[model samples]
Target: MSDPPKGPRVILEDDQPQIAPRLDFGWDQAVVPVVPPNPPSRWSGFGRAAAGVVVLGLGLGALEAANFTAAQFTRGAVQGWLTLGVVVAGFGLIASAGWAELRGLLSIRAVDRARAAFARGDLEAARSEALRWAGGMAEAAPLQPALRQVGSIAELRALLEAGPLAGLETQANALGRAAAVQAFAVTAISPSPGLDALVFAWRGVRLVRQVAALHGLRPGLAGTVALLRRTVFDAAAVAATDIAVDAAARALLSNKLLEQFAGEAAAGALAARRMLRLARVAAEACRITPPR
Candidate 1:
């Protein structure tokens, strides 16, 4: 009977029960397929063919015209030779401009590749990319000695940031600050919202171009458009809450001056914030080794 009554008595452990370890199913590690899910459309193929045909036709027509002009000149027509010379000179200029723009685009791509290499901690790749990028810019001449002495990716990056990149950053900051202040003033004083929009748009584009130039990127029309698109998208990705909080703080401070100016002040603050964000994004986009 005593043994039966004591049978229910049990000892409890002092330590807490252990939780089962989480099992990783590796869903996040799924690799993307090389082939797209959707097949190429026949319409796309047709469109490409049509474009090729149009380009070929244009080339043939230009060649035919050039030949005709040369033949006329051989037949003693001074006007034909003059026209051919003008045409040749015009083509030469166009070709030079196009080549410059292509070089600029290639420069941009090189910077992007260097940035990617740095992000991935590929030291050799990053070093080579950095050297190639710096070689193209005259402003990097002063850093050439230090660059040659770099033994590691970190050293190279530090040298760049302290030398040419530092100067570029300074210029970019000044540009951004000026743009922001101008945006604020314009938005606060302008009566027309349309005018405010236009001013902001112009300032944004100009600021981006200036920042890019500071980083040794002389983007032409196409490059400018590309940089503008990238900067805008990057700026849009910035935390909205952070911008709102900053704007609110500024608004609160400005409210102390005059309640009458509250609405205009808030609008101006928002515009200024946007301009600043764009400037920063543009700088980052143009940097050889963008911030991690």
Candidate 2:
């Protein structure tokens, strides 16, 4: 009789699925790694102005010392009114440059604190800081609307959390675009290039804060990654704006230095669009309304 059919040979191959190694890129992590902000570039307009003033002052001092006689060198008697005027102007420019740099540093710190607050789950603190930041523009009567728009972001956050998602995207798009345009208007009326750049930086910070608030997200490595990604996509526009603004500032000493306003405007528009996209992603990810 034929032997009973042998059972299928036991195949002992290792069938365990391989797992991929974890990457520490900061994405998909619960804790966001904080990266320090880069120091301002030496090529910045303010830096150059400060440097030039220093050189001018040193050159004037050397010339005065070399021509020194028994009599003390008085401002009026040293050279002429032009020399005295140059000395006074150099001091003023240096002071202004220092002040601008200080303000920029302060602004960066304020933004960092706000981000940290949100990351720690203190939404109220985050909102308060943002509102305070927006309040800065309330001093100018013309900027009241922009201030209101900035303040109204809280309402949008509420709506984003509770309202239907059907038309929310449209609302986000419109609001973001409007805010950017308002920023442009405010910058256009700035009294100086220093002030224009200051306003621009503050508005960008506010926009980022507003968008972060909308999704109940905070400043963390993940958010930073998102921002970097958005920036990459719009780098050309942003770079063009920087070049235009710098060239304009360096070209003239007048208030109407931004001859290439169109490029700056385009940059603002692109930034706003990116902010809207960011809010959308955050809202979709969270799925539920954030804590009040």
Candidate 3:
């Protein structure tokens, strides 16, 4: 009688932010697992040494058994020793390189574990892990206020989830400060220019992906690239920041450039702050929540 029941009854509810499914924050563990290319085996070094010893022994035995002149025998023995020395030196170099590579892998693994802890909402655990690597540098004086306000990983998640625009701005501010300290910590722990670039790139990429995920994006290469493009090209503020950060990080990490400590700190802070802007823009574009 009432126009076929006017379709189904519709109920309206107040608008609110819904808690989206939590994303796994173990990005480093997933992407930067502790897997260094295996160095030449110790056995190879041992074999080289053994071969060198055997060659020396054969030379000595030949010199003792032969009826050659003393000069010829001495010359042959010298050549054998020279060969042995070369082999031994090469082996030493390989061993040194292997040790250095292993140390680098262990350091990266430790960083990954700390990042994983942070992802899983264990701020204290994450902080402790970073402290172990950074030896108090992770908690620089400049970042104390931001860290206090952030309180915990859960609080950060809430800000990402349902907090207002102001909340997102606050989150950005806090995260920017935290990231600055973390970058300094990273550089303190690893002084290599190439290694710093790689580590910071990983950190930056993972952060972008995490924000996208918070806004319901699947973590994948395509999404990450797209969001990065958008952040770099669509948002003027973010784009400007990106340009500035890129220049700073380049200066900070350039082996050819003699960089001062103050310059490095400034570069790191600016890079981090810009990264937060990238995250915010990506999240907003992804529509993590309804527009105000």
Candidate 4:
């Protein structure tokens, strides 16, 4: 009988590990494209200014006629000039206010564009626009932070995917030195059944991280990723032949503390935090690291 097609498939035929994880790799534009939000036209401010000028001019003209005609007297050229200046001044004030609002509109457009890029899996584009939106907060003393952290997540994920590393993940950093070393594999030649199980789980956790980071999950979904990362590493640590690999992945995943970042608006931060912590501890049984 033939085996089912639903079985395992190798994503990459080449056994390339010397390359390491990509941290600086540019985003894959081939990934789905996100529809960017419309950018506000600079012309909007001009339109508002034009409208204000017309209205102010008309209003001031009417006032001048009313004052002169009601008193049955024509004002001198000096008075006429004074009235014209006042009308122009009023129009200027209105134009300035409209320009301010126009800035806000343009900013919102940038944010929308950023969000769209992220959805499309264009991480580079998303990160670029996200930084712009974040600057909106600085420009707007609006007493509110309207933009979501979705952009920030996208930027972070893109950085991690660049395929370069130095330190460790748990350190809230971009690199990690080798904490230890171990020899392990998934071949049938392995000595222990427990080792097979551990290898499978360890690989599984790495898969989860790869997928999660690829998607740029929001805080709501981050917990689920955390759950998977911690769980797989824990299992791998205990069941694998190499304790170092398990310990290192565990240390790295734990350091991110995605749960701890649950903010006042974080709906599931607490739950994620608790679950991630418990899962990391479960990895304790697999620990090969010396007491810290």
Question: Could you say which candidate leads in TM-score?
Answer: 1
lDDT of 1 by residue, 1-292 (tens): 3454544666665574676557788775665334566875566888899988977876885788698888878888787878788878876887789888887787678778989788766778887877776776777876666677778778878888888787877778889889999999999889899999999988888998889888778887778888877776667666475567656766676655665566567678878888878877888889988685
User: Model 4 over residues 58-107: C-alpha lDDT tens digits?
Assistant: 68866875575444424566776666666568767767666655643443
| Every candidate's lDDT | 0.79, 0.52, 0.56, 0.41
Candidate 2, run of 10 with poorest lDDT = 282-291
Over 4 Å off in model 1, which ranges?
A: 1-75, 238-260
Tell me the tens digit of each residue's lDDT in model 2 across 1-292: 9998888777554674466456577664755666799888668898899889988887786576445421334544655555555656866786676665565445545655755565565656655655555454222224334434543445534533343333444544555566667665765565676776677556555555455444333444335445445444454465566667656654663444354564456445444544444445433332222334
What TM-score would you give candidate 3 relative to the actual structure?
0.33
| Candidate 1 similarity to native, TM-score | 0.70
Model 4 steric clash total: 20
The per-residue C-alpha lDDT of model 1 at residue 289 equals: 87
lDDT of model 3, residue 83:
56
TM-scores for candidates 1 onward, in order: 0.70, 0.31, 0.33, 0.26
How close to the true structure is residue 121 of candidate 1, measured as C-alpha lDDT?
A: 67
> Tell me, what's the RMSD of every candidate?
10.5, 16.7, 19.2, 24.6
Candidate 3 residue pairs in backbone clash: none
